[model samples]
Each structure stands twice: as C-alpha cells, then as structure tokens.
Target: MNAVAVIEAAVPASPREEWLNRGKNLGAERRDVDWRLADWLSEGKAAGHLDQAGFDFLADNLGIGPAKLKLIHKAAAIPTHLRDTSLTVEHHAHVAELPVQEQIELLTEAKRQHWSDDDLRKQTITRKVETGRAAMLSQEEWDDLSRMQFLHVWNRASVAAREDIAELVSQSHMRCIDA
Candidate 1:
C-alpha cells in the first residue's frame, strides 16, 4: 500500500526579504566591507585625521571617482541607528546629501514604498532640482522663463500668432488664480 504525502510550500518573502536575498546572491560581502570603509572614513573625518590628500588617496585606491567617495562620506554622516541597511550605500548617499529632516522623510518614504535604488536617486534628484529652482528663481524670473519657452514653441506653430499666444498665456494665468 502506498500513502500519499502532503507537503506545505514555504511562505513567499516580503519585498525587503526578496531584496536582501538578491543582495546576498550578489557580492554582499564586498558591499559590507565598503560600508565599513565608509564608516571608518567618517570617523576619521570627524576626528580631523582625514585630509584632502587622504580622501584623494582612498578614492584613487578604491578605483572610484572622487564624487563617489564624497557621496560615501556623506552617507556615513547618517547615524547608525537611523540608517536603513535594507537600502544600498548609493541610496544612503543620495539621502544624506539632503537636510537631516528631509533625509529622514525620504528614507522613510523609500522604505515604506519599497523603492529601488534608482527610484530613490530619481526622487532625490527631483527634490534637489525643485529646491535649486526655487532658490535661484524669483516668481517674475520663473514666469519670464516659462513665457520664453512658450513663445519659442508658439513661434514654430503656424496655427498661433504671437498676440494669440500672449492672450492665451494671460488667460491661463487668470484661470490658475481663480482655481
């Protein structure tokens, strides 16, 4: 007599777990060492032991660009407890470049949304662009830039003359204020 055997399948892993597994499959060991190096660099920087030459040497020896080393140093500024190890060093580096409060908010959102490193980088870039634009442009300057861009496009379109485009732009501004 043959008896049938019942086997239970394993539960599926969460996104974080899946990501961790993927990283484990990759060169996680090397990454761990990199993280440690970042920490060491941070400590040295804090103690004023690491100078420009030291940074340059590390960057050269590591075979990474100076910009990447700078990012690693910025990432190391994040406190150990607050750091989200689930994210890659690059993600931390991007977030660390932001203000402390913004860094926390972005990291929290990234973890909650299970964002990829690229997603985090994109969001960081967008925020930086917005911040820079706001700082560099007054409302009048921004409006001028917008109008210039609109005029450039309208000039190429035979359907709308300069006067018509100007009228439409004014109407759009009025509509925005009304809303």
Candidate 2:
C-alpha cells in the first residue's frame, strides 16, 4: 500500500483521529519565523545594507517598533551554538544584553534554578546594580562600607546626613578616578 494510504488506514474514523490528524498537520508547518527574521536583519546590518533608518523603516512597515527591532538585532547577534533553543524569545532577548560570560553564567543558573523570564530579568537587574555600586566604591571603602559599625551608622543616620555623606563619598571617588 502507498504511504498516504497506509497512514489514512491506520487512523480509525473517529473524532480523536480527526483531532490528531489536524494537530499533526499544524505541527508539520510550524516554523521559527521570528528567529529567522532576526537573523536576516542581523546579516543585513553586518553587511551595511541596513542602518538605523533602514531598520526603523522596515520595523515601521512590519508594525514592530524600533525597540523591538533592536531586541531582535541583539538576539540575532547571540551565536546559535550558545543559545538555549528551549528558552522563550524574551528569555533570549534578556540574556542577549548581558556580556558573553555573564550570559553563560545566567543561562546555566536559569537552567539549574528553573528560572522564569521574570526571574532572569530580576537577576540581571540585580547584577547590574551590584556591578554599578561596586564600581563606585574603592576597595577600602567597600570593606569599610560592609562593616557592621558602618551599617549601624547608616541605619541610624538622618536622611539629610545620609545624602551629604553619599555626596562626599561620590566626590572623593571622582577625585580618585581623575588622579
């Protein structure tokens, strides 16, 4: 018997069979079109065929905003080998903004922790904040700031006094950086 005939014969004439057949048909044509479009955009950008104006025009025509196009470009830049295909596009978009090492670290952590996109986004924000705060403090200042006494003082300080102290520390750090 022919393959199509055999397959049809195997599926008994029932509602379940009809639903299964419909699902199979739909699944057969499913494609990752968004990823493909992002890759195409990245290729065009890399080749100098697509600049900000071109990207904006194309995005406008497609009904997606410039921010979405930028996200797609970022997602496309991530090497295929490094991407977690099982993750959602939003997850990939979040990790794509991170540095390569941090991306790997977070992806690994996400898998280990079974984190949702929201969880990963929160972690990313925390990481950025911690890095920024660390950048603002010298090693000695960091050590001092971590002390219990300093914490107690900061906890007890008035709002105005806290602001003045922060301003002074920021100026001192700026001077250190300039020198």
Best by lDDT: 1
TM-score of each: 0.53, 0.52
56-116 per-residue lDDT for model 2 (tens digits): 8988898878877776776787788887765544567666756789888988898789898
Q: Each model's number of backbone clashes?
A: 0, 0
Model 2 clash tally? 0
lDDT of 1 by residue, 60-135 (tens): 8878777777767867878788787767677787777578888888988998999986678667756766777345
Give model 1's TM-score versus the native structure. Answer: 0.53
Query: Which residue pairs collide, candidate 2?
Result: none
Error of 1 at 130 (Å): 4.9
Candidate 1, residue 170: the lDDT equals 86
lDDT (Cα, 0-100) at 5 in candidate 1: 100
